[model samples]
Target: MKILVTGGAGFIGSAVVRHIIKNTQDEVVNVDKLTYAGNLESLVEVSDNVRYAFEHADICDKEAMERIFAEHKPDAVMHLAAESHVDRSITGPAAFIETNIVGTYVLLEAARAYWSGLNEAEKSSFRFHHISTDEVYGDLPHPDEHPASAELPLFTEKTAYAPSSPYSASKASSDHLVRAWLRTYGFPTIVTNCSNNYGPFHFPEKLIPLVILNALDGKALPIYGKGDQIRDWLYVEDHARALYTVMTKGKPGETYNIG
Candidate 1:
């Protein structure tokens, strides 16, 4: 299969690209804007592979995205490009809104156009996999907040959308757009909302890497509000595998909560 992965230079996106290039026979075309968080250095291991290709392009650019679709003729798309930092989103929401919401909208259109041009068999197998976060479900009840005897549940596939931060809200909006395209246009789209990911080559702005890097340097670890916010953590490699499994084997027009 020929797959196009947006934001393939970032943490999780790079993981996905590496998994595809190393473990599978599929070819990957990575489309990334190369933002501060999106570093090409993350994909150094797989960069030399014949199955892997990188494009320094933003998903928000409609013309460039269209050209990419025509040029690569990808069989599937894994949409992951966005401004993902919650603190950054709180300070500057415009980037999150533009990149997450508007960018996803544009990518969906571009992918749909490409999918429409395929043959019946290719169209049936083509997929638009929108990768999103579990933060879109808002804050789950932590065990510390309640008694240890009380049931602390995980975010399920049916969890209601209650995004608190701008970043999560933008992701929620993109998820909706992806679903809308599937429902209205018969596009073969699948949405996956996963837990927090932490692993190698992670950007320094995020909590896990920041904590580890700061602790090593004897710098203060900035905990948000007494270090009580709990999140379901998944290793980046684990997430990439789960995403690939779902994309290749998932049912059309169905939402799978991959964590």
Candidate 2:
């Protein structure tokens, strides 16, 4: 299968690309905007693979997305592009709205149009997987907020949408857009909301990497609100594998919550 992965140069996206290239026979078309958080160097391992291809483009560009669909005719799409930093989103939310919401809308429309033109077999096999965050489900009660004996819950697949920051809200909005497309237009879509991810190649702005880098430089490790917030952590490579499993084996119009 030929898969087109947006934000494939980003940390988790790059992990997905490497996994697909190294472990499977499928081909990959990496579409990334080269944002500060996205680095092509992460994909150096598979850069020379015949099955790997790269396209420098933003998901917000409808024309570019259309061209990519026409050119690659991919069997699956892994949409991972977004403005993901909550701190950054708090400072400037316009980018999050444009990339997370508008970009998802544009990508969905482009994918729908492309899928409409495919033959029955191609249409049946095509998949659109939207990768999202568990943050869409607002902050869980920390130990400080609740008694220790109380249930420290997890964000299940059926968790209600209650986003806190602009970043999470934009992602939640995009998740709705993808589901709406699936229900209304019959677009084959799958959504996954995973917990925090940590591993190599992570951008320095996020928590784990921020701590690692700052500690190396003897800089203060900034913890948001006393660092008592709990998060279910998943390794990037593991999350990539889970995403691949969903994209290939998941049911259409069925949302699978991956962790």
Candidate 3:
């Protein structure tokens, strides 16, 4: 299969690209706008593979996306392009709105048009998987707010959308757009909301990477609030495998919660 992966130069996306290129026979077309968080060095291992190709383009460009769909004829799409940092979103929300909401709309429309033109067999086999963060479910009961004996809530597939930050809100909006495309247009779309991911090639701004790099430099680690917030952390490689499984085997219109 030929899969087109947006944000493939980002940390988690790079892991997904590597997993697919190394473990499967599928071909990959990596589409990334080369944002600050997206580093091509992360994909150096699989960049030389014949099945791997790269496109330096933003998801918001409808003409570029249409051209890509026509040229690559991808069998599946893994949408991961977005402005994901909470601090950045809080300080400047326009980028998040532009990328997460409008960008998703552009990509969805392009995919819909391409799928509409495909033959029945090809159409039925195609999948559009939207990757999202678990932050859309909002904050779970933190350990600081609950008793030790009390049962803590985990984000399930049925969790309600209660985004607290601009980043999460934009992602929630994109998630809704994906499902709307499935319900209103009969698009074969799947959504996966994953927990915090930490592993190699992670950008330095993220908590784990920041802490490690800062500690290495003999600097104090910065912890937000009281530092008691609990989070589920998934390794990037594991998250990549889970995403591949959902994209290939998951049912359309289904939302999977991965941690």
If scored against the real structure, what TM-score would every candidate get? 0.97, 0.96, 0.98
lDDT tens per residue, model 1, 1-259: 9999999999999999999999999999999999888988888999999999989998989999999999999999998888989889999999999999999999999889888888999999899999999989998777877788867787888889999999999999999999999899999999999888989888887888889889999999898787777777899999999999999999877888766
**How big is the positional error of residue 254 in model 3, measured in Å on the Cα after superposition?**
0.5
Itemize residue pairs with steric clashes in candidate 2.
none
- For 1-259, candidate 3 gives per-residue lDDT tens digits of 9999999999889999999999999999999999898999999999999999999999999999999999999999999888989999999999999999999999999999999999999999999999999999998876667788878768898988999999999999999999999999999999999999999998889999899999999999999998877789999999999999999999999999998
Q: Considering every candidate listed, which one attains the maximal TM-score?
A: 3
State residue 58's C-alpha deviation in candidate 2, in Å: 1.4
Whole-model lDDT values for every prediction: 0.91, 0.91, 0.95
- Tell me the deviation in Å of residue 81 in model 1: 0.8
Candidate 3 colliding pairs, count: 0
Cα deviation of 176, candidate 2, in Å: 0.4
How does model 1 score by TM-score?
0.97
Task: Write model 2 residue lDDT over 1-259, tens digit each, in one string.
Answer: 9999999999899999999999999999999999888999999999999999999999989999999999999999999988888999999999999999999999999999999999998898889999999889897776677778878776788889999999999999999999999889888999999988999899877889888889999999998787766678899999999999999999877767666
